[model samples]
Target: MTKELLKSTLAELSLAENSTSIIGIKRGIERETLRINNQGRLSSLPHPKKIGSALTHKYITTDFAESLLEFITPATDSAERTLNQLRDIQKYTQARLDNEVLWPMSMPCFIKNQNEIALAQYGSSNVGQMKTLYREGLKNRYGSMMQAIAGVHFNISFPKSFWNRLQVIKGDKTDSQSFISNGYLGLIRNFKRDLWLISYLFGASPALCSSFLEGKESRLPFEKLGKGSLYLPFGTALRLGDLGYTNSAQSALKVTYNSLEEYIIGLKRAISTDSDLYRTIETHSDGSLKQLNSNILQIENEFYSPIRPKRNALAGETPIDALTRDGIEYVEVRALDVNPFSDTGISLQQVYFLDVFLLYCLLNDSPEMDNEEQKISQKNLEQVVNFGRDPSLELIKKGASIPLRKWGEETFEQLALIANWLDTAHGTTHYKTAISELNLCIEDSDKTLSGQYMSALKNSGLDNGCFALELAKQYQVKTQEHQYLELSESDLNNESAHSFVKQKEIENSDEVTFDEFLTAYFK
Candidate 1:
């Protein structure tokens, strides 16, 4: 493709005009405040729910967009090492600050640790250690690299003290407080954060490590990483708890490796050759992915949020968008968890696996399936969800009982082949092990983190929360054992080195309000 054509393709992939993707704020009744009303016998009633935040991340596309993810980019030449050294110092300073400064003035109980995790609740003896493990493991392994560039966190909260002073009489009360509860406010803040994180991580990650890192020269516009420097494609999100958020989950991946036309052909072959990958789904009289008169679009219109909603209330409904733009569209990777148990919410293995999987998706580049084929794919997805580990989930190509695991194995081999190709192209064997790990997951359940957590929960007689806490503790122990031996006494005593690093980070950070943060992010 020509430079101009590639740029336009990526821009179209981002669906720049899809304002329906924006999230909005709304006002409603505050359900949780009812108990407080009874306790105070308040004459003035408070509105139950208040909309507090809106979110959108800008799209980043360029004439050389296809070259973006072809290399890696970092704020510093060695991001991982620099971040680790800085975090080690911060951890030591933070420990002392907690006991000496913050504890005396702020609500110590409410303060989240450096890991951005809350302390353990009462009756839970393991929360403390869980928090400790998360901090230490992350510090020892990846350091604070991701957190630094991830941007500052602005907490959305209600001014409860102001609310308490409101007078009931029309003239007496100022009615200054917003209608939303602090919890909902927090939720909105989290939603905004999630969107931004997903966008940046999704679009930049592949480019940052692969293209920029490998490129001999800088690609950043004006050699600066300004807010609008490039088409910042993946830079927004909307949280939906464990189900995985997708508000900011749109990107136009450059078809540097394959064309949309070619991709469609690949999808057809994938299903046709592997009868196990397809299944029959009854269609409506119109005969498509669904019925025509009944109109899947009607069900979609009523039951789902717009591709992007103009306001927040619309977000309450489902926010799933399936349309693929002309060139680049973000692939929704929906199998992530906050791991309420782990401090960072995910593991290195999971991150590595995701990197490899996404590379496979991009390089192998499956074509879009037709309506009938799409229905079959949906059935395959449902089977993966409901009977994923089941050996016999009844997969059929041309109406034969094919085992699900067998199909899965065959699909993975195709993936592994792509991974091996990428490994050869990149001259990096790291991905081969990652691909092998998936095969291992297929063989031994214990190899995967999810399986390990399940085993821990089942054998330890603990709830999910408690089990996460214990595992965090165990992970911490392992991390300390591995990393502690690598450090020297001299490195520990280098306080000035730590200060210099912190100064650089502060200078780089955007000094802006929550509103400014949102505006700059989406713009």
Candidate 2:
């Protein structure tokens, strides 16, 4: 869709919808800290009791490693509210970490040793056991270092009013759920096409400690910061590049993004599909199951992608089950790095920019991603990740080579137009302000998060450890200085106490043995 078409569509809807566009935003911030003491080595302390159980906590949970904290916020239509909730979570969480500080960046810098990175433990319940088993399978396949990489997930969705208004405008009789799901699919296609730009501008994991490589060579030559720290001179996000998550089996799947049906089918098939090497993974070895099942994915969440379509699943409902029945309620953007400079690892401006970009994706015409286009997109993504800051960086657009700057300007031209529509709908110029900031980054790459990271490292002449830890301490102080309205420190403390009991209840409620559970699931 062109700027004219998007304006025309919004203009028609504004008359009936009263210029209201309800944009619900939910953010989950997962940070993997080294759990260091004053010495800056890895800490081996168990998860703090005051932080709540990783198994049952609604707000705080563990990701790949027990030390990897994932804080999720409830969905809110206001960016300020969502960010406040995130700030409170961080403030409350850091208060509980006895001696540890957040790692401050996407790439973890220091480790005493690899064995110290333990898979997150839930409990003895079947579900908890299954969660650990999935991580074990990941550790078995991808190594612990890859699983330890931390980032941010931004989930957003429009309300039913938007869909109904769109339907009324289109005069389409398709089922409301189908229409919404397909619209989200169109947005996904557009996102995949343009996400490289986001990675280039906002990507922050340009550097990593050599220990993370586990003796493997950097895919590209990396400049050394210190004895163990290495970074690509122009790397944007090494965490999302070739050195990141890679699965030979999934690479072969070639999941399609043409439509919702195709996307769901691909996911379901991948979950059921088996590989000979993975099949050898023993479900029961020492009276405990090894994984959910020996397939390409232990479950649907195992499929690593930069973005995913999501539906809020019911109890005992798989992600696929929820999406299959309820359609895509929202989409999660997983490519964002944890900005080292921000106290919250993200900023209001970044969030606002994302809102406009996502809306732009939805209002645009998204052609299906064919296999050849998929190849090109993947190539484009890798180039930007490794060499995005290079002056001669180019991206492929509609079979023609275009300078990244030129392509970015063309895309921003449309975004500027859409930003105005957003400002009109929200009754604020926040959307426009977001684009204006990014416009500066397009002109000078050094203004970008990635560029700033490199410059920061140079100014201090600090290794990843010294630099990130200093930033981490600075942000921790800033976070403590901030105030929360809806939630208090007392409220988080009470929630933590309740979650501990909930974990025990879940453990006591387990009736089926681990072996029995796996046998039944496989059948």
Candidate 3:
């Protein structure tokens, strides 16, 4: 029945008028990396001035630490154009670093202590101070080492015309916003159910320097590599596993994705509720704020998830408010590991595959997920991240165990159909080619990124840090030699100069004290 429904949906969407709508799919990327010294230690220097102010820059900004740089690309319909923009942004930034290089992996290089990680600074503006305080709270809750782990985020949204056609095909009479929001919610539910496949195919973080553990206890049976690294022989992406960016405190929230209202209500309750565990932590120290608040979550962004339904919030508006008012404008996939093989951290072929996968999520049959089903999904993701390449691995499906390879093969067969439709829509073979290449990874675990990365590490007889450092140096050299593709050097220089001016304007416009600002924000 599910297969028939998917087939019918695709058939309806294949009409000439509806097929053209697929060409309008928009996408954007946000890639994060840490700046390291020549020796691969985390850089202690402040954000580079030549890269623009992290507070106001539109394209370049700091995420958690001052050394953790985030590069963003504007939404575009062309995958090639998006990758070009990302490459140009990275190239421009790399040329400006005096003696620092961008780390090429999802895991951190080396850290002597927590003191080595500094919260990102955004000048003297009230909003800037609040940004730093939020990071301070994250450090208190999860530790700074976890914040150093970086990844790539892919944001995508179908055109309004496609949604309109989908609504017509489904014979729905609801309002436009209601239909679109519900459609995206269904997509989120399906994505959550099947995202373990993503981990098994594209996950790249198999090992890490022991320094990242920071003496913390873990249950994974990690083996020692060289003298300072630890790894799981068949691990795909340890960054998404138990010791990575997970929040144990959030387990009680029981957030559901059945509807936009339910999702918003859950998040609202979390931000408004105070936590007994966080209450003991000091909010103020030495006449300076240590954190934004002692709530379970300082803001909606603090709630971690593999994917998010997003709408660009206006000034002074919270993310949930924006969603409640205008509904979801796009969905951001946050589960991707930074691809070590690509200079841009994500390849164009990966983007092509993602387009097909997300469309499949949108068009497929998705039912409401109960708490039991949610638990199963989480467990499946955990299993894949830890032992994905193990031949004996199995995943739980509807209370029945299925071999990992069997499930993956079935998923890919469906994805192949969607890829063909996309190819016909664009009059090109790129989507088919991408699916064909990735399908091999499903057949043979050794073809996956994690497998290749581990093989390279073993062949060189170098630890994770040493191997990543070598790649970082090579990437820096290549970036310097390459010319800009989508953006020019002059364009980036102007953006940097304008960002400085914008930062100054914001600093001068602050009229109230930060305490008053925080009160108004929460109110």
Candidate 4:
């Protein structure tokens, strides 16, 4: 359907429902962990027990490293509830921390010594061991600096009611699971095509402490910021830019979102596809396992992309296996940079804008993306990540070039209508306000997050470490002082205790040896 038709359809549908559609928009946030001491150095601290076990806790877990704490929220329809839960996790964590502060920026600040940063360690259980082993493989494959760069993942899914209504609108007769899966794939295609917009608008890691770039190659025109920071005056998100180690191998995968089956086939092939380069890096000499396998992908999760299709994996199932078996339960938008300005690293406006944009992706025509177009999209994303604030910047479309502001403004014009439709549905102007706020960024480049961050950095003597350390402490205090919205202290404590028991149960239940488990899991 065209934009006009979609607008009318939304209007009609909004009136048909007793209230608004009140569609279920579930969110799950995963951010990598970092904690620092009073000296503003990366701390060598253990995961606090009061916060909950990283192994089995539903709310808190470790991602790439032990210091990289990943907070997971249950699928929540209310964005505030999701943020509240995330804040509670951070709140309790901050209070329990002796003197450590969570690192607020995506590109980490000053690490007193890079050698001191360690890969995550898990316990003796087979599952925990495998988790730690995966980190080891990541460290070996990509240097610790590459692995330390952190960002946020936003997982989104629509309710069955929304799908049923959409199917009725389109006269679709496929099974609900398959239909929803295809719908999400369509969303993914559009998101990839336009994802450069996200990096331009929301990407926040434009600078880093010079310490992070130690013994590494950087060609950008980086200016010295105070004693430690090095930043690109025009950089959007250095974390997402042409970082050498992160994108090298995955770029060759060429995974497409044309269809759910096609996407799965591509990933499955990658998992089985061996890499000559990887084979040269022997993980172990013993008969025991080395890095899952000498494949292009250690597992499906190894294939990095700005966005991904996901499902809650069944016990013993891999991410790809779960999505293939159950269809796409949600699309994980991995393009978000950690917003330093907010106490929670995300704002209600960001969340609401995401809702409107994803809905637009669903309603808009999402043609299958070919390899050439995919390459173009990748190029556009990289450019935006590094130099998006450039007024003369141009982006590719259908083998043609268009001015970035023209394209961005045109996109927002449509988003305004989407925002209105959302406003009518939700009985609030939150969506429209976010759209208006972003449109201003297009109108004036300096208003954009990256631009604003750069301006602020200059005012602070261009010190990323100065701002990061202070902001981390401020956010920690804000989180600690905020009243619990959904969770009581007692509830959080019980969760921690029960989660510890669950971890023990998991450890006790593992019957197979680590080697056997890895072999079986890889297969």
TM-score of each: 0.35, 0.95, 0.99, 0.96
In model 4, the clashing pairs are 33-68, 33-69, 66-120
> What is the C-alpha local distance difference test score of each model?
0.27, 0.81, 0.91, 0.80
lDDT of 4 by residue, 40-59 (tens): 77777777776788888777
Please list the residue runs of candidate 3 whose C-alpha ends up more than 4 Å from where it truly belongs after superposition: 284-287
Best by lDDT: 3
Candidate 4 residue 260 C-alpha distance from true site, Å: 0.7
| Residue-by-residue lDDT tens digits, candidate 1, 1-523 | 2224323322332242321121111111100000011111111211111110001100111010111100001112222332233233223322322111101000001111223322111111222222233323322222222211111111112123222321121123322322212222222222221221222122111111111112234332212122211111211111111111211101111111123334334332332231211122244376422211121121122211111111122322222212212222222233232332332233334444444443333223133334354334434433333233333445554335566556446546655654554455345565577667667655543434334433444467543323333443443343344332222334443533453354345435536643344334223
TM-score (C-alpha) between model 1 and the true structure? 0.35
Segments of candidate 1 deviating more than 4 angstroms? 1-332, 338-343, 370-375, 396-401, 472-523
Candidate 3, 1-523: lDDT as tens digits: 7767888989999987788777788999999999999998999999999899999988999999999999999999999899889889999999889798999999899897977999999999999999998999999888999999999999999999889999999999999989999999999999999989889988999999998888877799899999899989999999899878988778788888999989999999989889998887874557666668888899999998999999999988899999999999999999999999999999988999999999888889889987679889999999999999998899998799999999888888888899999999889999999999999987789889999999999999998999999999999998988788888888999999999999999999999998998899899
- Candidates ranked by TM-score: 3, 4, 2, 1
How accurate locally is residue 408 in candidate 2, as Cα lDDT from 0 to 100?
A: 90
lDDT for model 1 comes to 0.27
The Cα RMSD of model 2 versus the native structure comes to 2.0
lDDT of 2 by residue, 1-523 (tens): 4767877876785673546744433444443344455556655777677789989887888888887888888887777877788889888888778877777788876774667788899988988888898898898777788777788888888878777777778787999999999888889888888988889889998888888877766559788886678888878998888778767788777788787778889988888888787887765556655666678877888898888999989987888889888899989988888888777677889888888788789878787887678778888999999999887899998899999999898889888877887787767898898899898888789999999999988798888878888888887788778887656888888888899899999889888987787677655
TM match of model 4 to true structure: 0.96
Comparing 1 and 3 by lDDT, which wins?
3
The numbered model that scores best in TM-score is: 3
